[model samples]
Target chain A: MTRLTRHDARRILDGRDRSGRLGALLDAAAASARPAELGGEDDVLTAFRAAPRHAVRPSRRFLARFVVVKAVIAVALLGGVALAASSSLTPGGEGSPGQPVAEGGRADPAPNTPTEPVETPTAPTPSPSDTSIKPFKGEDGEDPPEPGRPSGKRLKQLCRLFLDDPRGARAEKDYPGLEERAGSLERVRRFCERLLGEGGDDGDGKGEDPQDTNPSPKPSASHEDTSGPGGPHNGPQGHKGLSARSDGTYVG
Target chain B: MRPPPPETDTELSACVDAARSGDEDAFRALFRAVQPRLLRYLRVLVGADAEDVASETWLQIARDLRGFKGDFDGFRGWAATIGRHRALDHVRHQRRRPAAPVPDEDLTDLEAPSDTAAMAVDALSTDAALTLIASLPQDQAEAVLLRVVMGLDARSAGKVLGKRPGAVRTAAHRGLRRLAARLGPDADARPTDPMIPAGALTPRDAT
Candidate 1:
């Protein structure tokens, strides 16, 4: 069967659905359904107040939760910002500080004091000082020769170059073309051997040379490993300051 | 099927919005506007225990109003749905009980039958009308109450009744017809032209 319309129901409720006798019946039916004030408005108010807070609306508890969420997001954002800033400030941390020193064994070296004068390469017969070994095989503006294990001959050349031209060692960090094997055990051994004068070269006026010329108190701060006079002396302090600055910036 | 309630007053809508946000004063206004009819609807459906069902219904309404997603008419329909559920629960609870409701407790609030004849307005007694409505099947009685008393449209009433709009409409028509029949031929003043056609009022005829 087709249904009664809501309009019809409203008509019945309002006593307007039917007219004449039917209207009277609708009116009579609706009148009996009139809301007898169950109680006063105060009762309703009391009931409304009595309802649990969560049921009522978004209460203060929700506001408190939202505040907590906002606080967490803010702290996370600040942390991200701090990390970004500190990373930019200190590019090299502990991981990269010991980077330039390629070979671990060559960390200790004799002081950078050239026995031979650089101006005169024309030593008679070059018998006393061996000029046969050249540490830097490459000429100016050319790539150096390929590096290999330092032999006795290669160490003599490395020690001679480390003292006379320490820039060559510094340049290896910037351009590791061929002098990549610049620091090796054999090279370190040869350097020490040269300090002791393995041959009779110490007898030919080498006795006047200062025997103990190691630069810094720390063995790690090798004179040949540093570029300038200040490079060896202030290198450790500079490294410490960088690390401390990164820490302070990270926490701040 | 149900056209929305015609109470589109800006102030009442604003009050509903405020009530949804847990504004006590706005809810108070809302309660005042809809309570009377809601109570009456409950009365028709649950008889003497209507007030108790109504309180339960209000508790649910207050709890769920925050999530309610409609204007004033939607609010009314929503409330009627809750009230219907409460009434059913009360009915179910009553059915399980071995003892019938005590007559004294049932008759306590209303005036005694002797006094009602003298004091009842328009000589149309609530007790008499409720008795007539209660005689109809549960679906028909609730349909009539929700549609007529609560001012819910067919669709909304159907939603509350858990019936299709067509079904709710049919129930209401049958209910009114049954009431007219019980009241007798004399009650139907217009006999020749029936308000509800024999087949029932379809959506087409409702227009």
Candidate 2:
């Protein structure tokens, strides 16, 4: 029971008839990996042809889901249109009548009273002062100001707002129609002005210049080893005989 | 009628392009051409599970055949690399699952029975030497296979194994030494045969 010498290790490691072993191994591998029961050359060819086609075709599951989604949307749209059409055809159902209705099936008001007065004033035209609040224009028409300014107490409130609960921001309505809040819109507008900047100045600490284009590591007095430690030359430059090249390249 | 000589890489590339466009026959020819090499590589990578790995490798190649971008040689190497990886994975799996025990037969040391008669009458066969080689470890086996089967030099073998050329040369040297040891002290004294037959275990009858 002697330990194998380097020579023995080498001899064993370098032995020749590797191809036969490789062949044997290949046979063993082929036995297990290939789809053997699938049949012979014709079967293989068929499978090969079928496989690529199957891969290119959309998966049945995906196609099925796509059809179901499209059908559901189409049904919903058709149902909406049918309801709309039925409502339009039925009288006294929001659609305007051709003539004015009478209590006893007779025209009541005088025609001179004006069937449709030209200056009846249906709704007042909004004044410029009423529409004073304009949308905050963004830089390059992108990443618009997030609305509202945040100063001292409001800034502190904002800090608490985010720190207390970040999800609260989503609940705040930026538009007029739904879920009105008490003075929250103004607060948000002011907060956004401070956060996004009074004029889209980017009030966030990053400010106007986002990326730091210039970077400077601390200067060190240590000299570089040009000769590469073990190589010839005395100075840190390590240049043995030749000085700097004419093109300003360091010659070692 | 003799069909035109075996398709070259350029021809194969053109065939693969057609195959990608659903040209069934062209794809089949490409598969037949590369399957053998892929199988061989996988076998080396995974000893007994070559079939499973080779099948899986081919199926994968078939699935991704349309996406193949390289020339024939590149395609071959890429496929081999994939097969090698799959084979390695199978080997790892087998190691995890303890299977049947390997026979304690030391084929490495099996000495070819003395054949003084062959030297006297028939020529020495290369298979005798190769059989002696098969008894070596996987590394030596691969080195020999690459050299003899692929006709690669020691440097090329090193490139395949990602090792230094000197290391491959040393491995080859050691492999020959083991062969000599198996042949007995007088093995070197026996005339060495150079010619080899394809596929068969026996070398060409002594030159």
Candidate 3:
């Protein structure tokens, strides 16, 4: 049936007071629902006075909570300062008042000793160990390189960079042609290796370096895989996995 | 001036006048006379937690009772305004509470027997219906209940709900639509005439 129109609504409401079923019901309800204890306004007042102060003086409780929070913050600040100062005073901090001599290590001077300030040569940095081992060749039957592991600060810096600008880290390879964008060869090489070494054949893998666009070989596919980073449909093309909004565009 | 006792309408007005003149008993009597209806109104407008709200409403009335200068109806309207505010406060409080399953057994008893029976005669007495009505977005439900059940006209209901008369009518319409939907097909069979038709002489029709 078509929903009750407003006129019908008005009718139902009006008919409730008649002697018919609905009307009788309404009458009974109205009669029975006479709110009692209506004269006990003083009792309600007495209860109001007896009830919790927190309900009555909310601002006071709020102030108390604020004071407690401030006191805790003050204690925490004092404790942190004390801990930091004590730790800095402990034995193994930076270089002592006087101690050692190594190229990249600390220099030392003893008490009462007139030491000549020597100009230490800022040495040429040692080159990183070659990581030229190719990601396992398909025919060799070796597993794809485990990209999850990396050495020293490289891993930390990579993690920090990825965490900070995840999008840029993924698209690092697409950047070389852009004028202001520059990346170190080692960093680029590492990014490329990480991209290529991930085992999944899907081109949609995230945390991938945009420079290496090669489609990995599927375990089920025996055909020779030809798609690589510089291939026509490969590099910096068709990245996926970002969220799409209602407007039919990818969101951050 | 000595405060008048607020047992009757004249007493209530005199009590208010005396309280205005700094008579504490007059103020206390005024509070006693109005507190019950205000509490019941709050309890219905809000929920069971209206005890606290009722308390707060009275405290406000005690503080502001002298400010009201009118006949008994005006005093009632003033107290009603305070009660409505307390009810709103309770509503806001309920919203802030985390959602949890309302146990079926928890709803075993409700205080509105007469109301339930009234609804039952029309076969509209389901607990769910009451809850659904109560749970409707506040503006709509308040307008509908104040106007329909309490017999307040749109203008008076609007004043109690702090909305314009047009807004109150709209809210009541929307609220009834929602309530009809909740009622399912049964609401179709109900009579279709205004409960209180315009220009009705009898108090029953008037309400």
* Residues B81-189, model 2: lDDT tens digits: 3454344434432332335321223221122343466432221232233343444554554555444433334554554443455776666666555544443333222
Encode model 2's per-residue lDDT on A111-174: one tens digit a residue: 3223222111111222323221111000001111233543445454443343223224322222
lDDT tens readout by residue for model 1, A68-115: 455445445444444654566554333433232322223211111121
> Candidate 3 chain B, which ten residues in sequence have the lowest lDDT sum?
B198-207
* Candidate 3: tens digits of C-alpha lDDT, residues A88-162: 765442342222221121121221112111111011111212110111011112112233335334443443344
How far off is residue A180 in model 3, in Å? 62
Locate the minimum summed-lDDT window of 10 residues in model 2 chain A: A132-141
The candidates' DockQ values read: 0.05, 0.03, 0.04
TM-score of chain A of 1: 0.22
Interface RMSD of 2: 25.6
Best by lDDT: 1
User: What is the Cα root-mean-square deviation between model 2 and the actual structure?
Assistant: 27.7
Which sections of candidate 2 miss by over 4 Å?
A: A1-44, A52-252, B1-5, B99-134, B143-207
**lDDT value, candidate 1, whole model:** 0.46
